[model samples]
Target: MYVQIDLDGPAGTLRVSGHGLPTVELLRSPGAAPDPLVPLGTRDPARLTLTVDGAPARIRPAKGRLSRRSYRVDAIVSGTRYRLVPCSYGESRLTRDGRPLGTLESTGDGRVDADWAPGATPLDQALGTALAAAFGTGAQPWWQTAADLAAELIP
Candidate 1:
């Protein structure tokens, strides 16, 4: 599972990708703490790859950086791509095109919450709506489906 977030302003391109077999629990976690890299749906790390904008970036657990569960993804993107990576996730955020938007967060409880602060933009609102549609309200277990695999862009 992954998300390509394009933000406007000085922020850069930001992407959230799940290297191994992604689970509802893993994705929904606020990631308040870093945990050891565990292979998704297996006892070992699942071999995976992501090619963004024609460049391949490997995603894996940090060796000695286990304290930080977040994988270190290479930032090979440039230009506007770099400007959308740090938009604050909240209401009233602007899109890369400078549109009014709102930010949405997925609650571990299977509910999608959206905060609409002042100056919110459409991109933010679209993200919230997209999350609810993509992740849904519970463990839909769609990843196991054939359609899900293709949708994930797994060649």
Candidate 2:
């Protein structure tokens, strides 16, 4: 199933729908700076809740200080942990217990794209991207972006 995130204007939040019914609302903190794109420098992270069948999966955002990482959302399902990490080329990686599981990429068409590894599921990847869109805000460069740009234009 595909995940759709609607920019909820009045509520100043995002409505994510997929893997279930009606829609799941991802609410930014009231104190969070409101913007269609959450700023790269901000410490605030969004929140989301998901339910499959009869169980609940919590997507909670956590800001990092030592890593200098802006934020990470941990989606825990039945005690299993998953994390979102902003990677190269405006892409985010979802990791399970420190292992690469999947990736979410933003395309030129203004749509979110997801690519999963061997065993990762789409639902978890979608949830990871939801709170993990900081885009390397507080982290260092991943090198790929720099190399790509340098290769494209040789001055």
TM-score, every prediction: 0.23, 0.57
For model 2, residues 59-99, the per-residue Cα lDDT tens digits are 65565433323445566766777777666536767888788
Model 1, position 91, has a per-residue lDDT of: 17
- lDDT of candidate 1 at residue 21, scale 0 to 100: 18
Candidate 1's displacement at residue 121, Å, is: 3.1
Off by over 4 Å in 2: 19-24, 30-68, 107-110, 132-155
> lDDT scores for all predictions?
0.28, 0.53
Per-residue lDDT of 31-53 in model 1, one digit per residue for the tens?
Answer: 22322222121111233222333
Q: How high is the lDDT of residue 38 in model 2?
A: 48
> How displaced is residue 154 in candidate 1, in Å?
40
